[model samples]
Target: MKQRHEVLFKQLESYRSYVLSVMENVTEEEAEIIPFGFKNNIRWNLGHMYLDQYLWIQAVTKEKCGVPEQFKSWFGFGTTPANFNSETPSLEELKNLLKEQPAKIKDVYGERLEEEFPPTEMGMHTIEQVLIRTIFHEGMHLQAILDLKKCIQPSF
Candidate 1:
């Protein structure tokens, strides 16, 4: 079980690195530029990744999330661009949050595997299940960021 957790942890770390690398060269304007017909911007996508991960991992695990209330609704499962009006954190802030996530997740996993995770409208999930979904969700957005980058700054 520990070995499985380690593997999942490493996979999450790799995906985190991939996300950071994609955002490294993106300008502020580029981050906010929504591709035509797309509902959310890159900034929203990045923020959503952090918010959702924190919600599932920390909130569900009965750990301290420290998420600002103002940003909470932006991350709700059914939120769309039409309903999400908050500004995104700066690129530096987003990167810092990403940097902190792996350690936080490891610490939480170390302390609380036996406890039940919180229920959601999407239904119940084990800790491992939540982590897997979070990883997949991040990958989806990372691909979206790539697509947006290609559209906004083709020279890169």
Candidate 2:
């Protein structure tokens, strides 16, 4: 399982870069624009991924949740993009956070993959297990973001 997770962490970095590549060259307005049928925009998707990754990673491991406190209000699950305000991180900031976060995860938990879960609801036993779950979560959001881009801006 550890070996699988080690490879997964690397794959997470690659998937994150792909997500960022799909998001490049979008203006703030473009990032913020809610497509005709979508509930969230590109910016919100990026922020939510950052926030969710922090939350899930922390749930399965003992490490500190890395993002700012206000992330819960703006980017937590069930929060809407419509609520994105001045306090929301900028496009460049979000991009930077997303870029470095997977590497940070590897740094903190790479060798610690067998750590027991912290009474989490997911019934996961080890940190690597939850990290595996996160890979799928991020991939789902990546597709959602790409769908949003197709509605608002093509891949660039």
Candidate 3:
């Protein structure tokens, strides 16, 4: 039987593919365009997804953030500010990272997570619970990207 983590891994893999397909042929301007001013650009959302995963699987695990430092600020957890500078990785790089990250997590999933991730803290979840939260969060953003694409390019 597949473990819960395995199931989640598969779902995350599909979500990653969905995100990539949405942005595959996008121009830089389109990637950065924030439709309705209420949502983040696709580029920022992608980076944030990467960063959130990295923080959970790596930072929370007391391992390295596998992604480059120069691009960290753009996607680093708790770093998304309304007026923050947006730095984007090339499409090739982003696609590769999205593909690579799930494998990396699977590789390390069996290792004991050293940090104590409490279920709640001050009426909120601890970091571990937050990681699970991010999985759903990424899914929501992926859907948003699809909706945004339809809005921006109706014929697509």
Candidate 4:
């Protein structure tokens, strides 16, 4: 089971790389643009994925948010990116943090997938299920980053 968890964690690392590639060379202004019909930009989508994943872990493990305090308000699930003016972490900073996340997850929970969590309201009883859901969530957001990239690119 731990070996399976390791594979899932590697997938998470791949997802992070996918996000970085999708966002490569994106400008802050472009990242903040709310293209027609989209709810967020590359920036918000990137940050949201991180914060949302953190929240999911918190929910499943009863652990506190390991991310910065602002993540909860600025990029937390449902936090909109439109007209954002306040100071937020730069994309590079976020990128660095994003890169560091999976290693941290593996260090902390790598061997503990069989550990039982409080029964999830959503019915996830083991760490593996919760982490698998995390991978699914990351994949969904990775696709969103691609969608946003298309929307932000100037259509000829």
Please tell me which predicted candidate would have the highest TM-score against the true structure.
2
Against the true structure, what is every candidate's RMSD? Answer: 2.8, 2.1, 3.9, 2.1
Which pairs of residues collide in model 1? Answer: none
Please give the range of 10 consecutive residues that has the lowest summed lDDT in model 2. 147-156
lDDT of 2 by residue, 1-156 (tens): 367776888788888989899877788888888878888888888988888877877776656776787898888888887677788898889999999998888887788778666667878767677777877888888888878778776633
The whole-model lDDT of each prediction reads 0.75, 0.81, 0.64, 0.76
Per-residue lDDT tens digits for candidate 1, residues 9-97, read: 88999989889988888877787787886877777788788888878765456666777865666645666545555364666777788
**Per-residue lDDT value at 100 in model 1:** 82
Task: Report how far residue 1 has shifted in candidate 3, in Å.
Answer: 9.3
Better of 3 and 4 by TM-score: 4
For each candidate in turn, the TM-score is 0.82, 0.90, 0.71, 0.88
Off by over 4 Å in 2: 154-156
Q: Across residues 33-145, which tens digit of lDDT does each residue of candidate 4 receive?
A: 77778887777777877777677777788888567777777787778864355678777777877888888877877787778888778888776787788778878877877
Looking at model 4, residue 144 earns an lDDT score of: 75
Candidate 2 is scored at a TM of 0.90
Clashing pairs in 4: none
